[model samples]
Target: MTDATLSRADPIHYQDATTLAALIRKKEVSSREVVQAHLDRIAAVNPKINAVVTLMAEDALRAADAADKAVAQGAVLGPLHGVPFSIKDALDTAGVPTQRGSKLFAGRIPTADATAVARFKAAGGIALMKSNLPEFSAWTETDNLVTGRTNNPWNLDRTPGGSSGGESAAIAAGMSPIGIGSDVAISVRGPAAFTGIAALKATQGRVPFTGHYPAVTKRWWHVGAMARSVGDVALGYSILKGPDGIDGYAVHPREADAGADHIPGRLRIGWVAEAAFGPVDPEIAAAVASAAARLADLGHDVEPVDLPFLGNPLGALMTLVFGEIVPTIKALAAGREGDLHAIGAGIVATPDPTFAAYLEAEAQGEALRSAFAGFFERYDVLLTPVNPMTATPHGAQELVVDGKTVPWTHVMAATSPFNLTGLPALSVPYAFSSEHLPIGIQLVGKWLDEATLLRLGAMLDRKGGLDERRPAL
Candidate 1:
């Protein structure tokens, strides 16, 4: 690429994947130019943010060239043709190191791409790099023995939330236009909120978890999309959604419709600032209320929702997840426990769950889902805070919310319920805190109704006024 080409494509790195694809298809910019621009941006900014752990510069450029050739030949293009996207290191990418931020899997490369990665590639997107994550992708913050920590591009001293932290940081920093991240509870949404990006954790089965780490039978786990814009999240989710023949749990009962015309003129939106979601920070609560008011002004039926049964499920989630964690660590470590990361060590030290407790947690999950089902029957969407607070300082194990100190894990309060209920949820930056950190609001939709979340998210994305600001990186 020439200096002129690099200069021209520089701003393209920040454009959403959907726009990039359209530009490529129209021959306004070459795929190589797009890929190289991102590679350059990653090289320039990643050391400061440390989001990308393994970059596939050569392979990506080669793929970009092939995409340009296809366009030159006038071949029909996929919706994401010529786009560059990152993958959370937790997801497998064939022939590329798929280390899930643990030394145990360091340098390990898979022979086949994770279904999500394969779908992106199949749609003509380039695998730009592998983003960082907590070891085994089990922590709420992105730090690991394998690749160290991924800092928030917005504030280097703070974390970018995990286990999708790196993916969000990369997108927020304009290193990659879009990427895929796994979410058992809050991985995708938490990171997106922390980094001022947009992400969607579709209903659990909407996307297959076939090649993600911690290959467990946890029904609450999900694989989803993280992008700088809701439009990109919508596009990426559409490509990643549908069942892969291998993952029996992955099935889409209905196709997604993100078209503006498909959305109703008015939606019944129920919002909750606190109560069931634990003690939310005042700023976060205000952001949720602001989003609700914006929707109300747009002629939607907006009301504060109170559901006693919809309590924070993070405790139950821990009971189920930690119960599996001990065994999963032992099996994956395979007598190499001494070499496991600190998080893995901590997990192993935690007491195993009794059969009764595990069963009770399962029942709690079932009840949570049942409650959400009934609530959705009354409301088209539920609005809440994505986290109790904005991004926290690196290594912070506790957080103070509304004058009370709570364990850092409480950040998952608003997010884990939807995971347990298997509902689609969107996280989009709504406002900034006094500290200038981005605060996000969560939009939860009925199961298999990501289209609704995406549609409403588009509305919020436009009015949130966050699109005008990029991290001062």
Candidate 2:
């Protein structure tokens, strides 16, 4: 499609956070006015996209008034003061329903905010709404009995990607300035890529996951920011990072240098063209390759690298995820047969696995982690496809990758391994496919070294100029 067509089809939503904050700081716009603008935008576009499942209009107006008060009093303002943001429905918001896209807990509301939500509020962010997610945040497509499905803002027939799909869809449609999304796997990255937005999955534990449903008992789960710009992600991360007294898994003696920013220079970037893992969708691969070439043009040294360990990253991830699931199911089910979600019911109906089999899967995961560690030794950043394909149509619970009728879990293969290894990764829009859907490229970085990745991503963001293209909604 022509640039003009894409522009008219899906308009970019939300101004840059920095710019918006500055306007608030300057009194050019009242905090209430800013919040209302977003609220109105959501009302205008959300019905077409269905990304936002819950609105907090009253709470947001109150917070906006407080933000305006702080500015009037000359009170020290947080970096995100008066900025409007959103969270995936899976993240808890006190008093606001967090259905988690599951009928299991349709009206559930938390008594407290998720760690990331608290941080965002503490930074003076106004939480306007909650975005959609897959049922129990387990699927790649955002659909559940509670909130229904979220359509791609660019095209109603296509998906927005999930379990963070709602956030991606909302951001892409200009409903929210920035959003909070969790990544146990590709939930954040995949959706961001599919929707052509920017997202970062900080090294696991960088952001506390406490208070999120499906309680992030696994240390590999991550909470990060999603936005239209890298700088906004950085600003959101700055506010959201650090320890909450409640989460023992939260990173301590934080090694991240908060003030440091990535400076461009000659750097080593590992480009994974192919591996035994499977074939990448040709269009997706081309987008990644094009991104690599753009990085090379920006003076970085890019080379193709081998990632043999990822041959069965999905298998390892399934073992790890299902290992956690078995117990969660038992607890959520509470011995009540047929009470569980359909997918959960299917999972439990299968006969219990032999202990030997469980042990073998765990062993395989450990081995895969070891290989990723070795791979990182030779590469500062690893660039690959976020998903083997672009966003699939809404309601597709399963995807066919490389002729294998894989479960939704395969969508997270490229991402979950990094989560397992505790590495940082970012998903940036690369190019559009033959069908005109956005394709995303993944950039994985060393553990806790998001600065380098963000810097490289910023350069790519500048060079690829995907930001210049907006979807018509």
Candidate 3:
């Protein structure tokens, strides 16, 4: 195809993997051509966005060639065959720099791919690059000493959201069709919400965490997909779900497909209008109310729900995340502290603990999990603002929402409880703020009930047509 034809007619850059696969099957486009279009787009757009920090240009081309050859032989193609995708730098990719957005592991390369990455390759997805993340995958904003910060494509002055912020920005800017991102708290959903993309934080352990840096053994971590649409998230999840022998936490016996059938008509949705732990920005609260109104307009039953156990769970979660850093901090700092990140360096510099604090965190987490179970018994799904405000300016550490200064962790308060509960949650774009910044409302479901949440998200997507609205980059 000529460059003009590729630029104008190529569906690969903007289309989801499922749509691209069908086009490939019809010979409307070749896998090699489609992959090349994405590579060209990446080369063109990535410098401004700083989304894909590590490029696999040659490897991506080789894989695309292989995919084209398979098609030429009439070979079976997976759902994501020849589709270009990116992974958060926190996930391992064999022979690639999988630096977890830290200077400490500046040149660290992995010998094997993370289980989720392996699954994507097995499903015929091509890895175009590795996206950016927070240092050690610890923070919500995607900035570090290694590769600098990833800017939001919508407005470069604002952040994309993190630690999966890079992936969300890349997908939103059409840098890649879909990308893999992990959610410790709101990493995936928050970024997706901010960038006007789609993301799913699967029930914990649904996708393996093996080969992830700063290895998460405590405070349940989940690997999920960031994409432009709900259907794409479902397609990616289907490919990445299942056991890999290496990750003990990888789900065994397989998870039943949780796509969209679980959504019911006249659904009862519990709406939390305010931040459970802190005050929400008025615009964000209005966005949530607008989404709830949309659901009500569709005849879904929407009612206010109060979560009294929020503060304790968040406090316990912080203790858990910060407590894990103590060891890493000591090791890195060698008992000397400078900044908080340096204190983190000291924790890493310290010796490994024989009796770790993870156990205590786990114990507290169990109580919080029980509280969420009781809460879910009364609500089919919970709707809350994904972030208290719209996208914050890049380099913003503390935000003043309603005249109260709040730390970045508060951004995850409305979303993280579900992570601790091992429940499924999705961030769906609700409406744009008066500033034209995107605002999203999260739909959270009971444990292992992602299908219900996704169905509701799809219903919202259809009703609101949010996907069609894009920031003019």
Candidate 4:
């Protein structure tokens, strides 16, 4: 749907948040109508995909009415104005059940919104629902004792990917135009790849992790925007970023380029396929090549570049993440062990983390970050596959890449390095697999250089025509 004909009845829920906000500002469509359309879409599709675990139908509608009233009264309006967005259950929503896809927090509700959620609300975006996730948003597929499982919108027999799986599924299926998702390693980018959407894990601390469940393990954690289009992700990021005063780690060393919308004339683009991560699916590798060729076609200097620590950082990343996460899980599950799912139970059962190991992992992480800092000194953007493969079958424990089986955990190979370095990474769909599953390419940028990443993402998105195709749900 083009902006020229946004007023037409063409399923307003499928429109990007930017367009919806513009339509609301122009009064071409009432906020109630827009919110109602998404609510209706959720009702119709949520049952099949199981993405939205909590529905805010009445509250969203009420918020929409207030937004419409603001428009009528000519009150100063925020950029979002009347758009509705989904939230990953990992984030808090006041008076709304967050649950974290765990039985322990099944009915838990926070009195205050997460910093990211508050920013969205302040920007005029209404909270539509809390999307599903694996227990404690830990696993790579969305399923838990409380919320069951979330299926891919394109194929119900497959997973939508996690821990941001539900948000990706909801946006890809048009249930919500945009939403927030957290990434420790691959939560945002991996799921966005699995579900064929656009997401950005901005430089760590760009978006505060305050108010998110299991918050202690945040050294490598990041909250980011997920949408079906790069523009919407960019819009959401603009509002979601900056320090909220409550999260000490969050800071705005420098603002993203005001001219991020305009890509600088030509860029030094570097892409890596299997070299960065071993054994990528043939089709996914081709997608990376296609995107590189397209970038070259766009008059940018494109080449294949490799970093020594690319595929080797996952061990250290996991070490640091699990070192903190295991204790947090054990503390959170003290009296609730019986309620824990298999994954959570297993996590809690792991041997106690060692301080020596923790320090070693931290050192490894610092070295990885140094490597990336050095690499970025010569390149503006680094491209790679978001995952070695596309969306896998539900509850998949292994994946076949290049006709060889590898543990599904290999899925993080292409993504974990960025988290270790706290560099900004963007996941944007570039093509579809032979079976028609969506394929996404990752774009990594220098620290606090999300502007360059998003700018290049816009060009790739435009040339790739991501909006030209949608999941045939």
Worst 10 residues of 2 by lDDT: 1-10
Which prediction has the highest TM-score against the true structure? Answer: 4
What C-alpha lDDT does candidate 2 achieve relative to the native structure? 0.77
Candidate whose lDDT is highest: 4
**What Cα-based lDDT does every candidate model obtain?**
0.86, 0.77, 0.77, 0.87
Model 2 Cα shift for residue 206 (angstroms): 1.1
The estimated TM-scores of all candidates read 0.95, 0.91, 0.90, 0.96
lDDT of 4 by residue, 107-179 (tens): 9988999999999999999999889999988889889999899999988998888899999999999999999
* Per-residue alpha-carbon lDDT of candidate 2 for residues 1-473, written as tens digits (9 for 90 to 100): 11112123332245767667877888777889878888888888888888988898988999899999999999999888988899998888998898887767889888888889988888889999999988777767787777787899778898887779999999888889899998877889999988888899987778888888677335667889998877778777788777788777775445565324434487778886446335567667666778888878878889887776565655666666766766776667665645445655665655555677778767776787788778767767888888887777766767776566766656676777777667789987667777777777888887777878787777666344354566775
What value of lDDT does candidate 3 attain over all alpha carbons? 0.77
Off by over 4 Å in 1: 1-10, 254-263
Which 10-residue window in model 1 sums to the lowest lDDT?
1-10
Candidate 2 or 4, higher TM-score?
Answer: 4
Give the TM-score (vs. native) of candidate 4. 0.96
Those runs of model 2 whose alpha carbons end farther than 4 Å from true positions after fitting are 1-13, 255-264, 334-341, 397-409, 465-467
TM-score of 2: 0.91
| Positional deviation of residue 157's Cα in model 1 after best superposition, in angstroms | 0.3
